[model samples]
Target: MTMTDQRRKEEGTLASLFEAERQYAPVPSGDWMARMEALALEEQPAPRPAVPAAPAPRRRSGWREALRAFGGWPAVAGLAAACATGVWIGIASPETMTTLMSSDSSSLLSALDPASGFDYAMLGL
Candidate 1:
């Protein structure tokens, strides 16, 4: 756009007015600055506390510890089966169980032990 001479003069006048206003701009007083600072602090969001990272998984104790002590799940299942059998026998009072319980322990050991006849000394370990 072509600027007329009048418009150029108006532009100069406007620039000078802006420069004068900038030069004569009032400095904020200390109280005003302090109040502004306080308002800024109020308006601005507070810094959030850092979120704690998720805690490490805790080691379990009690029943889980006892379960490990019993040689894990398979062993525990075997033990539970044995206990159930014992309870069943005690409650039912089976005839064969009574006979087995009454038999001599030495005779039972020899009967149950397949290695009874083997002479261990012959191995010369």
Candidate 2:
């Protein structure tokens, strides 16, 4: 009665007619299926080759060779003397020693006199 029902009925009638005329027999096969499968397998590419590993390099003995070439004991003594010279110059310099000596208690007490109302009790001296 409705347009959709009429359309569905028409479709079913057409489908049944087509089914009545259709073949129900199995299709005959050829060697084409086997050939196609063989061709597909043949067309597949082969895997790539693996890369070769490199050899490990030799260890160095250059540091020992250099120390032997320079005469190791003399080289060590020269380095120690250079370090001692630097320390001696740092400690023996007049300006550095004067600054160190001026930081002593006697210098601090001389800077503040007893008659100058300087609070020694506050300094805990």
Candidate 3:
């Protein structure tokens, strides 16, 4: 078939279909608005009995419970070690720690310099 003929046939079919729909479509009465208003004003059926609210869940107390859950005995041991280290530093004379740290640092610096032979000049030191 030619393009024009096919196009004409399709258009005629669509036009007939729309005409059939218009003829059969239900037309609402003029009182549709009044009927709708009455439905809106009428008491609605009682709401289905409210389902009882579930009991609120109990909340766990914060940090302490979290720490216990996460680490248990291992966590306790780590805390004890930290506390002991703090106490040792607090009790020791400041001069003693300074001297020890200074010597250790010097030894480490010397070892790194001689063993690696790295030049500080490369770092713009």
Candidate 4:
């Protein structure tokens, strides 16, 4: 049908539904409250018996507990990477350590500058 006919039909159906709903008067407040109280009483759990305390959880190994107590795998990977970097700088290349330590601030800045075309691999650091 046309849009206007469809709209009129929908409005009529909605009004009839609302009228049907309105015809049923609500339960009295006193009756409803009493029913709700009765239902609540019926649904209450019976008292549970007191039981012995649960056994203590098994203790994990010191390192395993420490790992979990701290951040887990991501923290571990970060620490591993930092240690590896430290070891590489300390033992693998003494020259790199000296160069980094001896270099002035300006040279450090130049190394960081992308426009200067600073090649880290070429520096052999």
Candidate 5:
């Protein structure tokens, strides 16, 4: 067949298919469109009054403020000195520590034993 004849056949088939579709299609009701138009035109109701905002509570200045107000700079310095002394003693003294954390090095090695399932052997122990 010629190319012009093939093109004409395809156009005829497409037109028939479109006509069948139009024949089976449902027509739109006028009342549905009118109702939709009325709904679109209708105004929404006014919103309700908003609740009054709550007042913020006054905040306390806490321990630092108390230290500044009553204890003063000397008290603060004494507290800081005591804290430093406690830390120094904790690092230097062995007897003051717990038995598990004492100068006994074997306790740490035994705690890392593979028989206990921790497998320190895998780390070349």
Candidate 6:
């Protein structure tokens, strides 16, 4: 057949297919929609019951409260560090402490009695 004849035949087939689609409009019934809604609600999870709140905590006193005021254990550790540093310096010092602790009359008496015109710088220390 000619090309014109084939094009006309295809156009007729498409026109009839669209005409048949326009003649029908399928829709769900009211009872079907109600049933669908009811099914949706039934498929949902159940709600949980309400729970009671827990009781309040007890109050702290005496040493426990005092410890909190001192910023807990870390502050105590800092205080211990300071005390240790002081003790270490006092024990490890060689020059001033050694001269001060000497039982010799001149050195000990001179270091104590600042009125004796004893200048620590005179020793070239």
lDDT of each: 0.79, 0.73, 0.73, 0.79, 0.73, 0.79
Those runs of model 6 whose alpha carbons end farther than 4 Å from true positions after fitting are 1-55, 58-66, 69-78, 114-125
Give the worst 10-residue stretch by lDDT in candidate 2.
109-118
Worst 10 residues of 6 by lDDT: 116-125
Candidate 2: regions farther than 4 A off: 1-10, 18-30, 49-125
lDDT of 4 by residue, 6-125 (tens): 765778868667666778967679988999999999999999999999999998899998899769989999999999999987777776546866899767766556745346557754
Q: How close is each model in CA RMSD to the real structure? A: 24.2, 19.7, 15.7, 14.4, 14.5, 19.1
Among the numbered candidates, top TM-score falls to: 4
TM-score, candidate number 5 = 0.24
Instruction: For residues 7-92, write the lDDT of model 6, one tens digit per residue.
Output: 65777868667657767867899999999999999999999888898788887789898888989999988998999999988888
Selected candidate, larger TM-score, 1 vs 4: 4
lDDT of 1 by residue, 1-125 (tens): 45655555677758667666878999999999999999999999989999989999998989999999989999999999999999998789967656767799865655556755344336542
In model 1, the clashing pairs are: none
Q: What is the TM-score of each candidate against the true structure?
A: 0.32, 0.24, 0.27, 0.36, 0.24, 0.29
lDDT of 3 by residue, 1-125 (tens): 99867765788868677667778999888699789878887857766988999999887689768777869879888988999999988888677456656677655564546544346446544
RMSD value for candidate 1: 24.2
lDDT of 1 at 82: 99
Per residue, candidate 2 scores C-alpha lDDT tens digits across 13-124 of: 6866655556564554678778888999999999889889888877669987777887898997898899999999887885745675678876655554453324655666
Ranking by TM-score: 4, 1, 6, 3, 2, 5
